[model samples]
Target: MKQSEIKNLSLEDLRDKLAESQKQLTDMRMAHAITPLENPLQLRAARKVVARLLTAITEREQESLVENGK
Candidate 1:
């Protein structure tokens, strides 16, 4: 997903997306181990997406912290 799209998501949405992506990544790995995926790049893409989602969530949390002076 694009950064713009990710940025538009709420914190709860981002967390849910991240959890779902991580589950998909795990399933992909298991499937790849049993029988090669038609496209291994799927795993890579999922990982990158997870990273992006986490980054957006973290940035938002930090912004809130700063705003609250915590």
Candidate 2:
């Protein structure tokens, strides 16, 4: 997903997507271990997606903290 798309998602949706993406990444790794994937680039892409989702989550959390004067 694009950063713009990720930014559009609410925190709840982002969390859900993060969980789903992490599961998919794990499955992909297991499958690749059993047999070489047709395209290994998929793993890189999936990892980047997970990272972006995490970054977004952290940004929101920090924003909340700042707003609350924590």
Candidate 3:
């Protein structure tokens, strides 16, 4: 997903997507260990997506904290 798309998601949706993406990454890793994937680049893409999701979540959390502090 693009950063723009990720940023548009609500917090609830972000958490749900994060869980789904992490599960998919784990499955992909296990499959890759047993057999070479047709496109190993998929793993890299998946990792990046997870990172983006985490970053977005963290940004939201920090924003909330700042708002509450104010």
Candidate 3: global Cα-lDDT? Answer: 0.97
What tens-digit string does per-residue lDDT give for candidate 1 at 5-47?
9988999999999999899999999999999999999999999
Candidate 2, residues 1-70, lDDT tens digits: the string is 9999999999999999999999999999999999989999999999999999999999998999999995
In model 2, state the lDDT of residue 70: 58
C-alpha root-mean-square deviation, candidate 3: 0.5
- Report the CA-based lDDT of candidate 1 relative to the real structure: 0.94
lDDT of 3 by residue, 16-68 (tens): 99999999999999999999899999999999999999999999999999999
What is the clash count of model 3?
0
The true-versus-predicted C-alpha distance at residue 52 of model 1, in Å, is 0.3
Q: Provide the TM-score for each candidate, comma-separated.
A: 0.94, 0.97, 0.98
Off by over 4 Å in 1: none
Q: Quick one: ranking by lDDT, best first?
A: 2, 3, 1
Better of 1 and 2 by TM-score: 2
